[model samples]
Target: MKVILVNPPIYDFSAYDVWIKPLGLLYLSNILKTHNIEVVFLDCLDRSYFETLVVKPDGTGKLPSTIVDKPNILKDIPLKYKRYGINKEIIKNFFLENNDADYLIISCSMTYWYLGIREILDIAKETLKQTKILLGGIYPTLVPKHAYLTFTNKVDYIFVSSNFSELFAYIGLDAKNLNFTNFPAPDYSHYKNLYYIVTRFSYGCHYNCSYCACRKIFPKYTAKTVEQFVNEVYTLYNQTKCKNFVFYDDELLNFTTTKQLFYEFLKLNLPIKFFTPNGLNPRFINKEIAKLMYELNFTDPRLSLEFTSDFTHDITDKKITFKEFEIAVENLINAGYKPHQISVYLLAGLPYETLNDVFHSLELLSKYYVRIRLCELSPVPKTQLYYQLGLDDTVDPLLHNNSIFIFNGVPGKVKPWCSYEELQLLKKFVKDYNESLKQKTIHSYAHY
Candidate 1:
């Protein structure tokens, strides 16, 4: 049997590769390959292999563009919209040359990225009309019903959960003994070396943070054994020899099972640096964990502090108190992490958040000598915040971009949403804050 996995084009206003790689689909490809199944990938986002490349303005890399039918909902958006990937003819020709795909798998990200998803499905239906289509990833997992409703007839099946083993069962493959260690390592060599590896050491989180979809998406919490994860890490390190590694686990500091793994990594004392692109759980870290991370040289650590005030305790996870957060920062600082090395992700634009709230959070993070990573709130479906916002389904999904902060309109305006002026001010404030920190860092270094 032949399987083709695809990461469809991103149709957003701006996108960066940002160490992004679809490990889930590639891992499945490895499994299929191990079972003697021919696996192929049509990575539409891959700039190197794509035929019709559009040189990005910033010049970091190129993005492919293909003229396809735009979704009806986004027709009014005044943007020169083109699917960022090789054109239809090129994709079809590539498929013909590499033909014989019995099954086709695609990965989806942001819930609002369905435009790209729809385009890929239409192409697959037209080109590989008989092949089975399976779609899974963050979007589908969070809003399975929305996906089913939207792509009901367009695609063959949708996998809501992240368990690849269950997918094997759906396709009648025996994967009873499949474990994390047995899972195929991502086929990163197939694409350009991006110098970063995204490895999920744990499956789920123990805490049911109301605003978090981690528990809902991955109901069962399990971490790969220390030996298994470290071995894979060492193997990938030897193979790609990439120095930077990113952890995608919702909770990287697994207090119970995975602490030993991190502890062991500290003992090994590898020189390779580590990163947590997805912020770490502040409540899980202590002096020991902080010391271990410092020893392992975890650069650019981001601690998730959804809100600094206790007012959000009910709606958000109130696991770590303000004092606890300070202590955690102090521990990292004592362990030799520079102030610039630490950052905190504050969900800035929740539906009812005020400018004062945003200002206060910034002040708190600044006091800890940590930079702030501001994320505009995007109320995903199934999460409590989504229902609280009462988002109109009729609204364009493009508006769902966190950059827009659609839910958090103004305080007392007729629209009852964040005003354009207010949003602009918030953006400016964050910009000024970051610039101030950068200038301060330079001045301090000069004095040193």
Candidate 2:
């Protein structure tokens, strides 16, 4: 049987390539290939079209996008809405060329970017009437009822289960016969050019942060053995010659095998630059791990210090204390990393969090020489914060966009915690504070 896998375009106010890939879909493709099923992969957000767009050495870059009309719910927002990816004409031409596939599976990422799925569905229905279309991924899995109701007639089926049982059954394969543990690495051969590889050592997070959906999406914490992970990375690096490798694990350092995994990576002695885009837990970063990460060339390591105040403890589950953060910073700096090269992610615009809370966190962070990466909270469905606020599934997912949610809030559901101007001021404060740090040449040991 022939199957087509598609990674839909993103419809958002702003979008950038931070070593993003359809990892789950690529794994599914590998499974299908193992079962001797023919697969055709199409990534709508492929960055190859924009030849002039400058991509960094680490493979992060901007996507080629075009302005589009905002939805009625977002019309009042001042930002321009964009369809960030290849043009629809390319999708149409692709379907016209290969219309004989028995099944077409479309994967989604953010819930707020569901419009991209709708766009792809329209094109698929018009071009391939015989193909059975299926929608899956974060959008449908998080809010299955809404996804089913929205695309009731458009899609033939919606795969919402966490495992591939339902999908295997639909495709006439038994789940018990497939080897879930030994699946091959994600298939990146479909793309003409490879930039970076995004992989995961673990599946889920042990900590249930109120604002995070990691536990909700992946209820159990599971990890690959050190050998399994190291071998995969080594093989992929040799195969693609891609120097940049990113870890998408929700909890990279918290895993039991993490330290050994890093030791194994260090032994490879390759010139690969590693990254942890999903910020690491500072509490787990001891001196040994910090030194290992430095020797392994971990670029701009970001620590998760969502808030510094005690009031936000319940929201963050008291993940890391300020003392722990200070130690992590000191450890990295002592291990040959400059304080300015380290970054901390401070979450802003949380429920019940005031501007003063954010300002205080920034004030405390200013004492350190690290860079600040401010993150705006986007309430995800079924997360602790979502249910705590008494939000139902009826709320439009588009309102969950962090860009406007921090400023406009949810219409008639929730009021804005901070106005647009206040958010801008906070951003400027962070910028100025980070700039001030860059000018200072204080010794790391002296500061401690």
The number of the candidate with the highest lDDT is 2
lDDT of each: 0.70, 0.86
User: Which one is best on TM-score?
Assistant: 2
**What TM-score number comes out for model 2?**
0.96
User: What TM-score, to 2 decimals, does candidate 1 have?
Assistant: 0.86
lDDT tens readout by residue for model 2, 298-398: 99899998888666765457688888889999999999998889999998888767888788777778777789899988989988788876777999899
Tens-digit lDDT track for model 1 on 333-399? 9889887678888876665567667776776566556777877776566776655666534444555
What TM-score would every model get versus the actual structure? 0.86, 0.96
lDDT of 2 at 12: 93
